[model samples]
Target: MSTAFDILVALGGLACAGIALVAGNRIGSVAAFVIMGFFVALAWVRLGAPDVALAEAAIGAGLTGALLLRSANRLGPVREAGVPIAVHGIAACLSLALAGGIVWAFATGTAEAVYPSLVAARVGESGVSNPVTAVLLNFRAWDTLLEVAVLVVALLLVSGLAPVRIAPAPPSELVLPFLRIVVPVAVLLAGHLLWKGATAPGGAFQAAALLTGGGLALALCGLLGAGRRTGHVLVLAGLGGLALFLAAALGAAILTGGLLDYPAGSAKVWIIAIESALTLSIAAMLVSLFLGPSEGVRDDR
Candidate 1:
């Protein structure tokens, strides 16, 4: 059954990916890509990586789909463009070669797995019950730190582009009440996910994505604006994680003699603090990415 399920997921994901690439309309392509993301998440779960599955669902599928849909709506409909038969043939051959190479590499690769055991042996020192969390927040903290920095850089680049805001649609009466309930629930869930991350398959990225989803809902309903002064709040929020993480890194280096090395028995506290800050920052950054440049006027009505 498990093998069959995995096969089904693989096929479904491939089908969706193909549809996404070849769909005649932007909306159709985006929808197909979203479905592909979900299928990929399922594949991750089947591979025994629930943490990856959650991230795939939240960031790869949900947040990315939302961004693509918004971009598609702003750009209007996609027009069909003809491709030269020779170009299409060349592209297909290159794609097949790439796919074949990837398959060969995976099939021939040595299954020497040392990292899992290393993580298990050192997890107690990492101050987190979850092995994945320990690896991300402790053993491989530099990677996570750089990931946050990448998000910060992406936001700066987007801001520099000075993209215009697509005037929001009229606020819907029904959405307001729905958002009131959903937004609070999203906040509560984000908090829970952040807290649970140390022991479970939840983490900053997933929690932040949920929080961003809530913020997007509010913005779409016109209850939030992207004005310059108001956007400063988001800018601060976006920087908070990186700032706090750097401070912690420097403090650790000074006190423990190594960067990101937490003092004995205090690793959990530091990791949790950083994750909390990152959750907020990531959410703010994502929302601001969707909002684009500020309109210089409040529109919370």
Candidate 2:
């Protein structure tokens, strides 16, 4: 059964990718790519990497699909110019060469497993029993910090470019009730994921994505306030996580003589703190990215 499921997932992912590549409609192509992301995420789960699956689902499928749809809407339809056969041939050759290189490297790579064993042996020292969390927050936190920096850069670039305001939905009888119930549930779920990251398959990225979804929901429903000044404030606040993470890293370095080297038994504290701050910052940054750079005018609720 497991083997069959794996085969199905592999086939599904390939089909989706091919469909996306060949689809004439922009929206259709984006939809296929989004489905492919889900299939790829499922494959990650089947490969025993739920964390990767979560990231893929949230960033790859969910947020990326939103961006693509927006871009597609903005672009509308354009007349396509036929590509030369020589150009297509060159592209195909390059792709085949890349695939062959990957296969060759894998076939020649050493079988000796080093990092997994090392990570397992030192999981206790990292203060998180979850190996993935340990590596991300303690064992190699500087790498995670750099990932946040990338998001910050993206936010900066987006702030400069995306200034158009999306008009909020007109007030409806169902909107408030919906927000009242769903928003709280989302908050609880986000918190649950944040707390679970220390010991389970949830973390800051996953939780942040959930919160961003909720924020978008509220914004669309005309319950959340947004403007250029508000966007500026949110962006400023988004740096809070980066600051907290760096402070933790530096504090750890002061105590342990190495960067991100948490002092004995206190790693969990730093991880939780960093993850919490990160959850909020990431959500804020995403919301600002989507609803930001507006004029001084507020959308009518």
Scored by CA lDDT, what does every candidate get? 0.89, 0.85
lDDT of 1 by residue, 1-301 (tens): 9889899999999999999988988889999999999999999999999999999999999999988987787674455667888999999999999999999999999987899999989999999999999999999999999999999998888777656665678877788789989999999999999999999999899899999989988888777864576577887889888999999999999999999999999999999999999999999999988887465243322
Ten-residue stretch with the least lDDT total in model 1: 292-301
Error of 2 at 48 (Å): 0.7
Task: Write model 2 residue lDDT over 183-300, tens digit each, in one string.
Answer: 8898899999889988889899999988988988888776777555766777887878888888888887899898888778777887898999999999988877777545435332
Clashes of each: 0, 0
TM-score of each: 0.93, 0.91
Residue-level lDDT for 111 in candidate 2: 87
Q: For model 1, what is the C-alpha lDDT against the true structure?
A: 0.89
TM-score of 1: 0.93
| Error of model 1, residue 5, in angstroms | 1.9
Error of 1 at 219 (Å): 1.0
- Candidate 1: where is the Cα deviation over 4 Å? 76-90, 296-301
Name the top lDDT candidate: 1
